[model samples]
Target: MTTTLFSAFWTYTLITALTPGPNNILALSTVTSHGLRQSSRVLAGMSLGFLIIMLLCAGIAFSLATLDPALIHILSWAGAAYILWLALRIATSPPTDAAVQSRPVSFWASFGLQFVNVKIMLYGITALSTFVLPHTRELVWVVGISVLLAAIGSLGNLCWALAGHLFQRLFRRYGRELNIILALLLVYCAVRIFY
Candidate 1:
C-alpha cells in the first residue's frame, strides 16, 4: 500500500474506534452506572468482539463473491435487539452497592456480539476490501490490520470507560438520572443503526 493509503486507513480506524457506537456507549454507561472495575469486563468484551468481527469480515471478503444482503439484514435486526436489551438493563440497573445485584456482561457474550455488530463488521469488510485485499492476498497483512485495529479499539473503549469513572463524582448526586439519559442514548443508537 502507498504511504498515503496507509495513513488514511489508520485515520479511519481511529475515528470509528473512538466513535460512540454500541461498544463504546454501552461500556461508558456500564462504567458510569456501575464502576470501572465492573466495566472492565465490558471493555474487554468489546475488544474481543471487534477482533473476532474483523477476522470474520476478512474471511468473508477473501472467500465470498459478494457479501450477502440477507445476512446483513439479519445482523442489523439482531444487533438492534441486543442493544435494546442492553439499554433496558442499563436503564433499570441498580446503583453501586444497592439492594439488587446485576451480573456484568460476560466475556463470551461480548465475544459473540461481534457476529452481529454491523458497524464493526462493515468497517472490517471495507477496510480489508479497500485497503488490504487489493494490495495483496497474504493473510499476514489482513491479520495484522485486524489485530492492530482491535488493539486501538481496546484503547478507545478504555478511554471511554475511564471517562465514565471520571464522571462518578457527579454520579452520587444524580445516578439514576444519568442512567436514564445514557440508556436513552443507547436506544437512540440502536434505532439509528437501522434508519
Candidate 2:
C-alpha cells in the first residue's frame, strides 16, 4: 500500500510539474536572462506560491466537496481564458537582450502571479481531489504532495533555466527564434487548457 501510494504520488507530481505553465515560462525567462543564481529567487517565490495555492485548494476541497459542479466548471473556463491572455502576452512581447541586463522580476510579483496562474491552480485542485487519499487526511496529504511537487517542479525549472543559461550566447544571437519557440509553447499550453 505504501509503495503504491508513493509511486502514485510521485507520478502525479511529475506530470503536474513538467507541464508547460506560467510558472515554468517565468522560470525559463528568468534563468535565461538572470542565470541560475538570481533565478533561484524566482524559483523560491514560485514554490511558495504553489504552496499557498495548494493549501487553499485543499481547504476548499475538504470544506466544499459539495460545491456546485457548475461553479467549478465556470472557474475552470475562466482560468482557461486567463491562460490564453497570458499566452498572447508572451507571444507578442519583445525579447530582452541577453547582454544588456535588467533587474529580475520581484519576489512579490512572482508570488502574486501564481494566483492567476491557471495551470498551477488547476493542477493543485485536481491533484488534491484525485490522487491524494482520505478526505480526513486531505490537508496533510495535500500539503505534503504540494511540497514535493514544488520541489520537483522547481528542479525541472532549474534544468530549463540552466539550459537557457548555457545557451545564453545562442539566445543572444537568435533571440527572435527563441521567442518564437517560447511563444508557440505557451500557445500550445493555452489551447490544451481548453481542449
Candidate 3:
C-alpha cells in the first residue's frame, strides 16, 4: 500500500510541477530576460519557498482534512490578477541593453511571490490529502512527499527555464509575438479561475 501510494504521489507531483502556472511563467520570463545560468538563483529561491509552502499545506491538510473552497477561489482570483499584472509589465516595459547582462531576482521577492502562488498551494493540498495515509504514518509520508515533490518541481522549473534559454533567439526575434502569447496565457488563467 505504501509503495502504491508513493507511486501515485510521484505521478501527481510530476503533473503538478510540469503544468503552466505563475512560477513557471515567471521562471520562463526571467530566463528570457536574463539567461538560465542567472535565472538558476531565482529557481533556487522559488524551490525553497515552495518547500516551505508545501510543508504548511501538508500540515493543514493532515489536521483539517479539507480546506475552505471559498478561500481557494479567492486565492485563485488573486493569483490570476497577479499574473495579468506581470503580463502587462512584460508587454509595456522598454527593452534595455543591460537586461542581457544576467540579473538575479531577489530571494525575498521570490519567496513572497510563492506565498500567493495558487497552483503550488493547490498541488500541496492535493498531494497531502490524496496520497498520505491517515495516521502518524500520514505525517511521515507527507514530509517525504513534500520533499520529493519539491525536488521534482525544481527540476521542472529548470526545464522551463532552459526552454526559455534555448528559445531566447526566437524571443528576441519575435518579441511582439511572444508578448501576445504571454498575455493570452494570463487571460486564459484568469478566465479559468472564475469559471
lDDT of 2 at 127: 69
lDDT string, candidate 1, 1-110, tens digits: 79999899989888988886777777776677668887677777778778877777778988885787988889889988888887787788775556125667777776
Clashes of 1: 0
Q: Residue 94, candidate 1: how far off, in angstroms?
A: 2.5
Among residues 3 or more apart in sequence or in different chains, the pairs in candidate 2 whose N, CA or C atoms overlap within 3 Å are none
Candidate 2, residue 144: how far the Cα is off, in Å: 2.7
lDDT of 3 at 164: 85
Candidates in order have lDDT scores of: 0.77, 0.68, 0.74
Cα displacement (angstroms), candidate 2, residue 39, comes to: 2.7
Candidate 3 per-residue lDDT, tens place, 124-143, comes to 87776766635345567778
Scored by lDDT, model 3 comes in at 0.74
Worst 10 residues of 1 by lDDT: 95-104
For residue 184, what is the lDDT in candidate 2? 76
Give the Å error, residue 171, model 1: 3.2
TM-score of 1: 0.88
Kindly give the number of clashing pairs for every candidate.
0, 0, 0
Q: Top model by lDDT, which number?
A: 1
10 residues in a row with least lDDT, candidate 3? 93-102
The alpha-carbon deviation from the true structure for residue 13 of candidate 3, after best TM-score superposition, in angstroms, is: 2.0
